[model samples]
Target: MEVETINVQEAILLESTTLSSRQKNEMNVMKTKYGKTMENSDYLEKLEFFVIDVIKTKQMDTLLTLNRTDGNVPRWFVTGFIRMPGFLYAICQLPRRYRYTNCINLFIDSCEILGMICDDVAGSRLSKVDFNTQSDEHWTLFVQFIGVIYREGNSAGFKTKLIRTLRLINYREGEYTSFVQALFKAHSRIVVLRIDFEYQKGIARTVSLSEALDDLDHLVANMRNNAMFDHMLGYIFKVEYGVDRGIHIHSVLFFNGARRNGANHIGHAKQIGDYWQNKITLGRGTYWNVNAKIEQYRQKGICGIGPIHWQEYDLQVNLLNMVIHYVCKEQQMIRSDAEPYRKIIRKQHFPKINEVRRGRPRTIMIASVSDQLEVESI
Candidate 1:
């Protein structure tokens, strides 16, 4: 698939509103109070400040913080990044006091106030969002915040094209991030495959991301002696056309036996790396070298107490949450860089991945069920 190109965030200014001199003075005092209250805070506190920002105007963005606090981003920066149309992606690691449902509802309420109108966040066919989940162990809600609109229909004057463009980039990116994070963490161990330097083509070479993955799929199943080992191989990846590195892939591959079959050590790492090099690279000439790194995260004891001021904001680490974010970090990949190659990359690079590839499901568990020829799970 071609890389998506979105216009970066536009510069925003708060809409002018009529306020009495006394009210303006009160806001000014609160501005100073906010600075002193939240100075020298860490990631946890930044999260709290985000909720406070939500509570301040009962929303965020519209460059509201511009008039209030001097943003010393390098030192006291917010915990997350901002996207197009001034949408704030704050890292919402819920503390002990607040539950995931409560935090997310607040975030949903605040973020829905964004776009041009209150209902602008409403889907074409849907209105509300249901983020309630049974699994709290792997939850990390990245709160999306927007500016508050005092007047209900204040957005009627918004141009049609501008409004459509904002909605597309705003929610689409959020949904993509959420889907990727959920899918990756659902698996037990995620193998991060970094396709470095080897398969990069200079001119007529159409080595796409899918091509490399297809090669890995064949080698992986073949690693299990090509019996019924197709179930052991699985992968999900994103291609990055770096400014200097050209085209490369950042992918997360899964194996059913990786955890119980001693796949954590470097011995297995080298074996997987060697398969990519010898088996997958044999026909690609001397230029084909595969660079692989296996990232295994331990979900235990990953939480820390809340920041000094925001002590209630403690957040537990989700399984593979870090790796999911790392692989899905398309924010750093320049669309302009990838745009030059998107046209040339073709479906031919993918071939018939499904017929030849094997994938692992979230519910699979390998256990002894009588005498079986190979591993089995229910």
Candidate 2:
């Protein structure tokens, strides 16, 4: 299988529109108040529509459409690092209330709108879940939306003139600070790498535990050297759920490179697997789907979340942040020095461990052996 380079530039930004019903309503309210309010009403209206409503609606639509589950991620619902001080900054600066019902309503409405458009475009009824389950594709779309929002929020247009009156919540207290923090601490860097693997004709195609471990070790070692060479503190480790079976890794490294100054080397990183895979191999008579690589881990069964278990995902996300932080600090990077990427380095959290288990085993034994390295940079 040949891995194609992911063009970050190929990211598609949804058309920016100023025609939201919510925005129009707010405009009328402002006009009724005789424009006497001290609030930066126009700016507030845009932020609410663009960032809060649009992003949330897109995410909710994907989740509901794919999972067929129907609980809203309320503005007040802190999804991990999003709860930190940074989120507070966002809320206060935008003055967007984290109302539960209103947020859900907006999400459902967005889904309906998308559904209507999709139905018309395809000339068929839009089924919530297709027979093959395109959940992964939907997830990719959601991630793209995230990328777009990040791009816009970080743009000079939104930051300079229009939002001058806005005092964004400090990165420490932003709405999604926990998630941001979990991902971007001064010391920890999220490294995503992609690798292509070719199987020896029909042999079971999968990576073994030792291979996964070796790849992780190599990445960490290089990360350490990079940090040391630059005379910066470095911490490095591969994050994984060590289940004594086949393994997957989420490696985080702290490097003291010039990245702290303002270089954006972040994304689905490609360097890790590039060194391992030489010439790309094309599959004969068959092609590989990108999503299969992400879901190849053999697992028996995992139970659903109980009431208490519901928070486990959040806990896991938080733990990941701590682990990355600890590793980076161990390597000598100071958290205080990460001011440049503060907003980009979100403090997000996952659910707790016990909450994730919810009493079901998530293990499936696979005796089959294949020769493919199913890895991607996250």
Candidate 3:
């Protein structure tokens, strides 16, 4: 039962040549139950080094060198194009807009060799994915869905940590797009707003993360309860950092005022700014900017205006969806006890909602060579 090797490991421990106690136990069990194809001691060490080296480096030659007789380990390996390293490179190495369909073709062309490269090399296995999830436009989506489940040997804490780290690294565009699409799909009329932080009379205040958070909290409460948006339908907020201007909050408000095509009082940027500024103050002399915008969904494009609105070219870009994507995008910030820290202020929206419409869920605990069918001849 040689499943096609994907080349990515279940966890970082796979990045090492030595097996954890859990992996050692799994191999021992597999040997007793399924019988060993090769000895575990020296050969398994070689296989471990091979997997770590190949996946991290994404070397084809390294992959070609793998052999069951040499590593003396079970044949489970990285599933599908997960081995090429190049396809996975876009996660961090390649341009955000970069797409290489030829890379998938390359994997298809070499699948047989890749299929022959590993023989019974397992410490982990991939879980089956529902084929319906595959998109005809993005074939790799299905292949990438399968993941190496590091058998019952890895501790729960260890697996949890690995999954957490991967969420920040793996395929995420689908998650972002899906959530954004779902929000605006229900409410097409949107407002994109930004609140900037200004020092009091040009004096920088002590802006700690908690203080900034407090400012955002107060702002959201006033916006929803204020006489201005009292007739509003729904709203959301996001916090982002400025390289020199400091921390600010971004929001998209979906109101019932689309009936006037944005001619109403809430549609005016100046009024929204004035009222928004009065609610949240950063102490002595400090203030927030009322950068607000109104957009309409017409002609399959978003029509809007603001100080920064001229640069927006795509009318199809939903301001609400854009705001949702901006806020929901992956962020990595560790704790800091100092003022002016790079922390995102908005907590996950109350009543967490993840309405994914593409790809797989963030977690997959268990995958096959037979699962590696080309949807179309490459």
What TM-score would every model get versus the actual structure? Answer: 0.31, 0.21, 0.37
Candidate number achieving the greatest TM-score relative to the actual structure = 3
> Which lDDT tens digits does candidate 1 get at residues 69-170?
233321111222221111221211111121222223333344455421132222111223222212121112322332332222124442342354345334
Using lDDT, rank the candidates from best to worst. Answer: 3, 1, 2
Query: In candidate 2, residue 137 scores what lDDT?
Result: 58
Off by over 4 Å in 1: 1-233, 258-260, 283-319, 332-378
CA displacement after TM-score superposition, residue 327 of candidate 2 (Å): 12
- Residues 26-88 of candidate 2: C-alpha lDDT, one tens digit per residue: 434433433322234233233334445334343443433432133334331212112111221
Global CA lDDT computed for model 3: 0.35
User: Per-residue lDDT of 238-314 in model 3, one digit per residue for the tens?
Assistant: 54433123344555444433332344433454455555455457243233433333433233355332222212335
Q: What is the lDDT of residue 211 in candidate 2?
A: 40
**Best first by TM-score, ranked:** 3, 1, 2
lDDT of 2: 0.28
